[model samples]
Target chain A: MKLEKIRPSEITPEHVYLSRRRVLRIGALALGTAALSACGLPSPSPEPTQTNPRVPKDLPTDKRDEFGDPANRWEEITNYNNFYEFTMDKQEVARLAQNFKTSPWTVTVGGLVNRPRTYDLDDLRKFGEEERIYRLRCVEGWSMVIPWLGFPLHKLLREVEPLSKARYVRFESLFDPDQMPGQRLSFYPWPYAEGLRLDEAMHDLTLLVTGLYGHPLPPQNGAPVRLAVPWKYGFKSIKSIVRIDLVEEQPATLWNTVAPHEYGFYSNVNPNKPHPRWSQATERRIGEPGRRRTLMFNGYERQVAALYAGMDLMKNY
Target chain B: MRVWLRAHGLQALVHIGALIPLGVMIADYAQDRLTVNPIQELTLRTGKVALVLLVLSLACTPLNTLFGFRGALRVRRALGLYGFLYVVLHLLVFTVLDYVGDLALIVQTVLEKYYIVAGLAAFVLLVPLAVTSTRGWQRRLGQRWRALHRLVYLAVPLAVLHFALLVKSLVGRPEPLLWGALVLGLLALRIPAVRRAVARWRDRVRHTTSEWRVANRKWRMANSK
Candidate 1:
């Protein structure tokens, strides 16, 4: 079914729209009067300044995945998170992670690589950045459209130069219990880890995200650095990286290790493959009132489907 | 005031306590504090309250059976009905608010999701119990009324299982298991042997208490003389 293009005005709730419009009008009137008196010239258009100012206009962003759906508000994207390292409660993660320290963080890259090195946050940023508006579909049957700012994972892989035998890229999050209280839970295997096939890691759509909505990543949203694999379920995009390893065999992931049947190793978002406990056929879009049909490979089928050409996703899942 | 409290206070407390969660949910909705997914928040909150009330209702019989707390029987019906009310609300939110009353989708979910099926079965079983909870129906059904209400023993466990299966990480979370344990303990108290033993213990305790009371009264009368 086709979803009618939702205009920006329709996206904002009525009360929020009215309040923001009033504030904008008052600000414009003041600016207009000042500009007229100062130089007898008309005030510059307020359109650019009034809209989302966090995301710079010049940043290159792909709009293909949006399909006319507007990006979720910054608050919705940041506040509603599934970083289990912080907490299981999605809304409480933001508040609990308010004091989390992300500075002085280093990600160690090794295992089946020629130029093994540990890069700090600054060193990682030197590879360059671009903005991509991607749909993040969680296995919990919820989704969000986020404008993420980061370079492709291929760039980092090229710099590291993986060995010929390296078959998988394993990612690990920080294991500090003092900072991340959720890590103290003995039930969960701490130091959250995830893995992707070497070729999948080299895909251009796979991002090593550092920011979102044109702002640096918040603590709850995987500050310092995180991975964003648009096609896979959100949990596959491991957060708060502290280690990276290239292995010959598939590495064990936290979710897969905990519950292999429910969360498969290749957690590509396939609506046909329903979760053991729930359906993946539809997802509730964050900030929206109703559910929407989930797309195959989260609507990145064109870019990533070729990667899984011969293999059956159901078995892999 | 003390006499009036003894007569009516426990019932009043039960009524108020059962409705507090609903009040909190409404307050949260009005204040926009239901988090990002308000429908999900409503669904989880209502479901949780329903389960809690149902468990509390189940505990009432054991309370009366073991300790001879006759007051426990007075609020049992109210607790069960309140639980039924929340279950209705929970299903309403799931149907109207969450699914927009999409019959096909709701039916599909009910068939496909085991948790939904379990919850639906629990709700189905509670309907007859809630309907016949009145004294008039109790009189009409006679001995059959007792047998009908025993369906609660089955319904409570199904509800607990529904909760346990609904969570994404049931292995890591012990809440559903804890609730299961509580239900099992309450069920165990219903066994005839256990009930008889508890009754005998209660009788012995009552006999000793009355003896002590008479002796204390006699001592007080002597001191006054």
Candidate 2:
């Protein structure tokens, strides 16, 4: 209750003595460093850049590396989400997902696959650690550069190869109203689902991301499983996946079902094709000062451009 | 005011629990768990709770009449104060922190948006009621007290209409419309003409539903025996 009652007179002489001692200690450290330099021991080097400059995702320079490299503060993860069933309130999912059942997660691989197998999260993790740095573009026109640690969908697909008939891979999230309260909201069609072209699914860049920034994904950030398509808008990367089905026909996505004009099945993050309501080219980097411009195919044109070679992105979007 | 304080001392403590959501929400914003403008979420959330308490306050009287519970009005005074407190906070937050002295935008909201206008109207109506709620004022005003308090009937529906119009066009939204319809239905039940019509309709329904009750009673007696 007395929060604003700070009195300068309360500071004793001993406190001033301690403050002086700290400055003296810092001065001694400076002298010691200079002396060490004179003795031929190397001076400490400045911190290296946070991101791996070689990686394509690191090309964007106007960003704040508040999380440091490979260990992002969990803030960005909780805030940036597309759990549409949770009333389109991005933070609501993360706040509301504490009650979600992440354990006992088993991905059922079925449909046109030769071997339809149910793999627990442990089974998937057994394949081991592989980190891929990627840029995630939200359909709402924001972006983040994240280093996601996970295995490729192709790696999993090879274990249970899709038949020649397979043209698309459909992923479904878990659906238990008791566990996921978003299901209670009558607005969203729960058991959120997303689809990917077989070619896109097979692409080296496409991943079934289990971790971000070298840490296991938090429950809110889609614990057991989530899709990570580096080239597409983040909405296409559905979270809390339970089933993956390979189909002959191109599959529909939840957003396209709700608003065909607003969201497209091929919601690839092409900066040139603006979303109807907002500009897609310019994006607010999550932890940065300036709004950085987005890139074509989220700056992965070389890797993913060929997949949509002849198609007009604007029309498709 | 003194009577209210004495009567609601315990109730005040219980209703203060409503402030927890605001604190938790602000904490989330500070923690960056929510990307929304913090002030915006807080304002909307407080306003929403205020509207809920207001609606719930009104529902008590009618609900008592329908359910034969006479003591329900005991809670209305405290609940009404909670609504008044939250509404004041909601309005203050909007005019002060949210606008940050942008007089033009504030004026624009007061003028352009019918919902904000209605909300402002409701708050303006509540001020005199809240001030005159004291026993002293009641005694002073005498017969005029009833006239002053009757404004609540108008304020409640206007507030709901504000919410309904405010939320109508939001993407994938229907909650406000449902609540609006519910308030409209409740208000309709209070009008003498509409009340009589509904009584006829409801009496028929009670008769129909009561038939199942007699059958269930007989089934229960047979099963027990």
Candidate 3:
């Protein structure tokens, strides 16, 4: 019973055999992961191009005011959006809103306004662009510093010339369900409405944003035109405006209409007044590792506090 | 190989399936695929997996009662512990990552948020069950172990409620409700009357099949002779 001597070539090297096993394990795991991920987990979206081709390489920026926080990366700001018009999933919004039509867009400014004019995207842009870096704090306890490009809403409001009867300014988003799938959901009072007091709407800090990071606003970030009320929660800054109505009474906003108790009409970024579901004391700044203390009026108290001077924010909230 | 698979396959499947999500999560983290808000992503993923495993664990008895799938019983403990593991991970992500180990914030959240309270309750309830899952404790505890494990009935619903209440919009989000429905159905199946009815139906089907098999065998034997 003589055992046959094995050739060097016949036997697999220890490292080779081990590596083969490792590869097999990895392959199996990867296959399983892919299958499971396909079940629901969001896949990374494709790299996006500059949303608007006509946007300039350089724009006149406001260099005076300093918040000291770095603006979130373009990808972070664009990819993570709460454009429920497209989808509830923040990451999916960018992908879903890729083909959204913002051209030939007209925003009608009417109710209780003297001019009662419908301004096209071109007409709105004539107000001229200024790069204003502002902190956008979401009601969901997330914050982002974004360099927004557009003029103040007050400029547009002044041109429209609000009547004395006009107390609240209501903004409505584009409501085409064919394009905005989330609008199809019957629960949300659709056309995604948001409102601001006349004073708040006319404030210098209240920007009617058209672009961000030197590029025309991406659809997910509210393309063509949107509002950026830095002092209020991000939702207060309505996206993709289709209508602006100045009425005597407060307008019905989407979130407020949905859950008035949870989402107040005056959803100011107040750390003291906690949301019914989550704490407002701290917010995780997007692209940052840890949570930071949420600021009173989102760190714009000095600028906007005078407007809400006598009013009770806690009661309003 | 088939016989070996038949005896051990379901357990192997449960173990592998249970760990796959954690592996995928780790892979996602390494690859930077956890969306822009990784903490929220991690929290959601871990919470969801925990809820699913816990629900699956709760399904074991109902599965056995309805279908006589004893393999479900064998993996029940493993399913539950995996669920507990995920719950722990979920809490860790929320506290360590999201809250940055800020105990004050965690306390505030747990106190302020009803959903967080519900989730915390579910996790606290599961702790004892996971601790006494071993055969040694099971034997010592005896019938009490079964009683103790019945906390799952409460824990599962609480977990479901936690998920349901946490969602921004309940109308658009049907997952928590679907999971609730599943848990409800599983709970309903555990009713003694329902269990007896299902067991009776199963027995009747088995009895009829065996009778047919016997008759066929007899006919074949007679013809051969």
Candidate 4:
């Protein structure tokens, strides 16, 4: 044969393939679909994460806020991180956490639950999964939008079946002093711990994230698994979790224990409440010029505000 | 070479050395290598440089006081000016880049954050020192100038405290503590009692060495006779 004619469908359009805006629009549409269906409507199959030539688009494009504000550069997202378990230097975390072993990890769910069970990584992955794009705000006055792959926390909680005595859900990170260098030094009360109220843990927006950017969670970003409560400050979403205990009384968290005056138990993203060391009114969004006005509950007020209806946010914060 | 270096060349070297950090920052910015959190990187780097140079400037007094080095006294003004420059750059990064020209937010931040308050106080304390560093102003103020410059003693510890407070926590950080110790040690050396004690020790050592030389000479002479 002299020559073969190229088929039109074989070649993807350059604009559709290369434009991040289009991908973000698609992500927003996906999120919109999820939100709509969540109200007793039939859930639609989520769009498969788009593979960009440069950046991976694995997380849902949140339909709310400015969806197309250029998902922070992938390098910025991965390189500039804050995982204190490895080291305090933001640049050094990725390098230090790279060698951390996370396989064969098990998380024990105990305390005031009807079914107390220790789950392997595989067991956690078996729960229903989705791509959720949410904004993460740090108490340090910086923010980032992340695409996380995980399931609703409620799914796992349902399986465990919390008893009537379960008022708060406690999460603890791996505390091996030999492995986690930060644990060796008592800068913080060792064995980083955090908690959420029963309702907050069971909220639809709460996620038990397992992966990010279509890859297994980076060691620095929290290895085997972690929690992602987008409505609260980043630290509230504990990383490299090893235990989940439901308690009748509010649990003592690491930050609260270290500096109770600064970090409250709730630690909800409230722009009105200023951190003792810094202002929370505005936050620098990574890869974006200047600071943006931080939103209430980090812009998830519509979905989460009702949860804290009468509670004084300032006092809780 | 020593003589030439002691004259004006050493001060020139100090000037060149002091500017290198700023040059590196500019080059990093131009080359697009300021890292992911460039604003933060710049802020922290400049703040560190300012604190280091401030401590170094303070060190000049102790160097001169203990060693009687005239050159140390000469470079004191230059180090202080450079430290002030870096402090300005640090504040510029925080206000312009971090706060982004929001005057209301800036005031709110300064009011609410104690670290910001401490840093601002340190910078304000340095302003008069930098302005009066000129030879003309120094001559005009005369004895008052020395009194005014003593404010650096207060400024340095506050700056270190500001640095300590701004970090995640001070439990593990030894850098700020080391700076604080150096400042305190230098200040302690300024006391008249400590200075007199050091001088007495030096005179005793000198006297003992001369006496030993004389005794050895007498013993040799007696043996020759």
Candidate 5:
């Protein structure tokens, strides 16, 4: 089934379209206006506050407004996680992951890089922060809009300095069977792995997330650090990342290795593509009323489309 | 105590124990604590409970046959009814909560997913068994009741396979495989040849052990005297 291309205007408010630039601009204007008003003139203009600058934008899809609150609650976001390292049960994973220690963590960034270096959790925190609310669509046909706080992944990639030979970026999760009980079972060959093409990894939307909803990331939701590839399936955003390897070849990911027919290396969220076990035409947003038609690349097509331009999405998927 | 439980409280105990999971699920729904996808959660939990209870009910016949537990036979009907109740709830949750009464979507889903077909088959097979569970029907059907009730044996394996298929992979999950093994074991024990073989082995072990003990005691007494 063909899905009509979703216009940016349909999903985003006009002001929200340039929110990063406009909000900062408005903040500066508001500050300048406040300064002007303090100096005092008889005639005063209306404050920017009245313009509803801080009011949250309605989420993508017309249904979001109809449903009122589109974003999944913080509790639901934190608790309902699919960290198979802990357990498969959505509710049990949070409690199980809580037992694992995320502090004193270090990620080794090596392989085909010009300047291979290890970054501790504290080192990662020093790269600065940005709060981005992105829609996460799981291959299993459920989605959540999460406000994640992290810097762009390219910042770290630049610091590491990828060589010309490095064509793919492989991510590896923490592999401790004692802490991650699911590792005890040979589920996905322990230390869950995910990879992306160099261009895809360098996308601005790809984030090395540290927190969500203005709070530190919960253990179940990949605490301390994880990748957020908004344009792809949730599994593409590997959790509890411990290693980043810039490789010449596309690294074998856990899901792709487990089920090559169902999960692909590029598991981009494509509504046209149906998973072997289930349909991907629509997804039920957590804490929402009903399913919405899934958009190509999970509605990040405008930003990430050029990366996959001239490539066959169906075959790659 | 065994006789009292057999004649009186066994059915009550089974009924109460089986209802606890359903009560917990209902309480979770009422409290708005039924996970993120409550519909899916409710559907899965109800389906699992039904499968587990169906297996438990099937085990009752083997329990009576192999272990001579008359109490197990007494509560078998209640167990089967509870299983049927959960199956009905499972169907309701899938239709009303998950699909929102979209019969077309349900039909599409059934066609697309083999697990759904397996589950439906199990549910359909149980309907006849449940209808004939009454004492009046049992008498009316006479010997045919036993033949009809044998459908449950087929239904249970299909239910387990449905669960296995629903997960998409049984490699990581042991619950489905364990349930399948249990049903297979129970069914194997029902075969007259297997049952006689087990009984003969058990009898031989018991006789030899007692004989050995008697000889040893006599030898000890003679030596002491």
Candidate 6:
């Protein structure tokens, strides 16, 4: 029944039809693969962001280094690392912290405060912004010229009535393992907390920063909320905070508790005393201007110097 | 002595491979491209490659037994040599780059980091195995050679640990777990019972693939014709 109308030529044509179909199928597949360059395809893309910040010479400048080298875009932006709450590894802190939704974030202020309160991000913003140029020294012996945009910590403290018994302010990072994977490993004592002496907590130089490099803090750089203690090593600048417990005793710090010799509570950038391994006198600038000499109290001696007066910094360190 | 030179030559080539990265790293440092912690990255990369090569190198022994790839015997030496070569490179990068060859820093790292201790122990174990891989050393050691080589099994897990600590956060990417699985799978397959079981499975998979290929070929030819 199938061959009723087919001639000998037509029979060969049907056979040829199958062969042509096969050829067409192969040709289509080849073309499809060529179009896709195979599913496991290769092509051009931006080189992995060796993302050093680059600022034009014309960009308005405020902060400069010890050498009086003007801070460029990278120094201001790229160098202000957020390896605090999550991982100390800069790249991993950036990568692993993508899921941290800064919305609904509220800094729960408790402890010595006479009026305990939870200030959501929006309410905190009403406090306004001030751009303070300061040097940020890292525990790993790197530094950056950061013109931080945030209100003074003194202003934030004024909001809540203090408990007279409270002598130190302890800050805690958001502790969800789902969001902060660095907590999974003992990278830094999980939940990444820090505290300040009462006088130090009320210092004018201390900052509750929400932005840096003139923009809202990128999620990796601790968006919405973080502490910015310019005089101390970068670790003191806790990121993605959730709690602030004012205490009578010096609350345990992650580094000082873990390795006391290397990380002292008085982690003021002292050029005189070296870290357990490396010299503290210098730090890599982490931008176009390259490395520069570190300064005493990260060059904030004029504003924060009175706080550390007469104490043996090396002994405290 | 020529055999000695040949063995050393193989290691030298690997050393050169290891050093090329070092040269690039130094160039990066000079050019202001290297990160603040260049040593950490280099050590992690070297350790990673060492472990992968260790698995790939160990794979040769199993494959030789399974498919009867007799030529793999000569190649196995090179593969094992490459593993040892990479491990030594990993160690060197840690010592020179991380600690700047500081004895004090080395002791601090060993005490502070269990992972570093694991890596140090692994490297220490691999030293004798690498030296004894040579025919002269093997003949010299005799029965002791077999005992020494068995240490490779323990070294693999210690090496795995060396890889794990570098994982700052395993939130989204579970590549570390997969790596752990592969290492564990390979080690488990060495058990006599597991070996017999895997042999049967391998034969089945081999038979299935061959038949599938035949079916595919026939269909293609018929359509073409």
Q: Residues A1-317, candidate 2, lDDT per residue (tens digit)?
A: 22232122222222232233344435445565453223210111232222211111211222332233232234565555667545457666765764455665799999998899999876887666576767777876566667666888899998898899899999998888776666787666667889999999999888898765544565577766898997888888888899999998878777788778768898888766645433466565555433456778888888889999899888987
Which runs of model 3 end up more than 4 angstroms from their true locations?
A1-65, B201-225
> Candidate 3's residue-wise lDDT over A1-317, tens digit each?
44343222333322333234344434445565443222210111232121222122223232223667777776688889999888888989987986677776899999998899999866886797787899999999999888888899999899989999999999999889999999888878788899999999989999999877655676789987899999899999999999999999999998898888878998999998977676699999988897999999999999988998899898988
Decreasing TM-score order of the candidates:
3, 1, 4, 5, 6, 2
TM-score of chain A of each: 0.80, 0.75, 0.80, 0.79, 0.78, 0.75
* Residue pairs in clash, model 6: A53-A74, A112-A163
Task: State the lDDT of candidate 6 residue by residue for B1-225, as single tens digits.
Answer: 798866565455545654565477568768855554455456666676677777766666677766766555556666667778878888787667545577764675476656677778888888888888999988998999877887888887778766665443344345677777887887777788988888998899999999999999999999999
Count clashes in each candidate, considering only residues at least 3 apart in sequence or on different chains. 0, 0, 0, 0, 0, 2
Model 4 alpha-carbon drift over 4 Å, by segment:
A1-67, B1-3, B201-225
Query: lDDT of each structure?
Result: 0.84, 0.69, 0.83, 0.80, 0.80, 0.67
What is the lDDT, from 0 to 100, of the residue B223 in candidate 5?
100
Between prediction 4 and prediction 6, the one with superior DockQ is 4
Model 3 per-residue lDDT tens digits across residues B71-138: 99999999999999999999999888988888887888788889999999999999999999999999
Per-residue CA lDDT of model 5 for B126-191, tens digit only, reads: 999999999999999999999999998889899998888867577776778998899999898889
| Residue pairs in clash, model 3 | none
lDDT of 4 at A78: 67
* Residues A190-275 of candidate 1: C-alpha lDDT, one tens digit per residue: 88999999999999999999876555666788987999999999999999998999999999999999989899999999999887
> TM-score of chain A, model 6?
0.75
Put down candidate 1 lDDT per residue, B1-225, tens digits, no spaces: 999889888899999999999999999989998988898899899999999999999999889877778898899999999999999999999899988888898887788899999999999999999999999999999999999999999999999999999887766677999999999989988999978887888889999999999999999999999
Q: Candidates' TM-scores?
A: 0.85, 0.52, 0.86, 0.84, 0.79, 0.58
- TM-score of the second chain in candidate 6: 0.74
- Measured on C-alpha atoms, candidate 4 has an lDDT of 0.80
Query: Compared with the true structure, what per-residue lDDT tens digits does model 6 show for residues A212-301?
Result: 554455567666688889889888888778898889999998767776877787677787776534446556554533234667887778
Indicate which candidate wins on TM-score: 3
Looking at candidate 2 chain A, the ten consecutive residues that score lowest on lDDT are A50-59
Of 2 and 3, the candidate ranking higher by DockQ: 3
- Off-target runs (Cα >4 Å) in candidate 5 are A1-69, A121-123, A276-279, B1-6, B202-225
